[model samples]
Target: MDYGEPTKLVFSLQDPKPVLCMNGDVKVTVEPNGRRKHWDYEVTGSFVQRACAVRSRAGHVVAQIGVKGMLAGKDFYHVVVQPGYDQAFVVGVIAILDNIHGESTRC
Candidate 1:
């Protein structure tokens, strides 16, 4: 993304189970993997940049994430994932959440 960092696409993890996701001032977090394992998308701390760690059950980082802020009312998430992360799986999870919570995209 020209507005942020270069985007990298990862293959699907194929497990789009529900997870708790939060973004506070561009600090994103996702956790609670499918098998009740403690998996978390740990976003790095930065005053300007937004980065995340896609962690595994063993608390090891499996991927990295970044994002570009979207303009108001875009109805889209501008996520940038590094290698070892599954882009499809991430997007699919969001899709599932949106399906269940129809107001997620409402501005």
Candidate 2:
């Protein structure tokens, strides 16, 4: 993902040891596959809470994910995507996070 900067994340199924966690704060750039030229989105929040605010490069918060099931379970979460943002894209980002954190998709 390129937001016109040096920051990016690269992943591959072939990689023996994939990175499961971001180094520090909960910040990342996401670009959908086959859409390298498409606008990349930024996700930023507290690493501890895992509540993320998805924003466009313009700094508008298009979506936000809340830790709803903090007391119930680690697998539960809630996301609110703004009207203009694609719901599928938001959900896809959430799904990627689930995979990275081993949330609901864990075996």
lDDT of candidate 2 over 20-87, digit per residue (tens): 64433333445335445534456677423667787776889988888666545554567789997788
- lDDT per residue (tens digit) for residues 1-107 in model 1: 37353454222232332353233212123532335433334323321233444455455555444445655633444555557777765555444444444435432
lDDT of 2 at 8: 46
Model 1 bad stretches (over 4 Å): 1-54, 60-74, 103-107
Total backbone clashes of model 1? 0
Q: Which pairs of residues collide in model 2?
A: none
Q: Which candidate is the best by lDDT?
A: 2
User: For each predicted model, how many residue pairs clash, with residues at least 3 apart or on different chains?
Assistant: 0, 0
Candidate 2: where is the Cα deviation over 4 Å? 1-39, 70-74, 105-107
lDDT of model 2, residue 34: 43
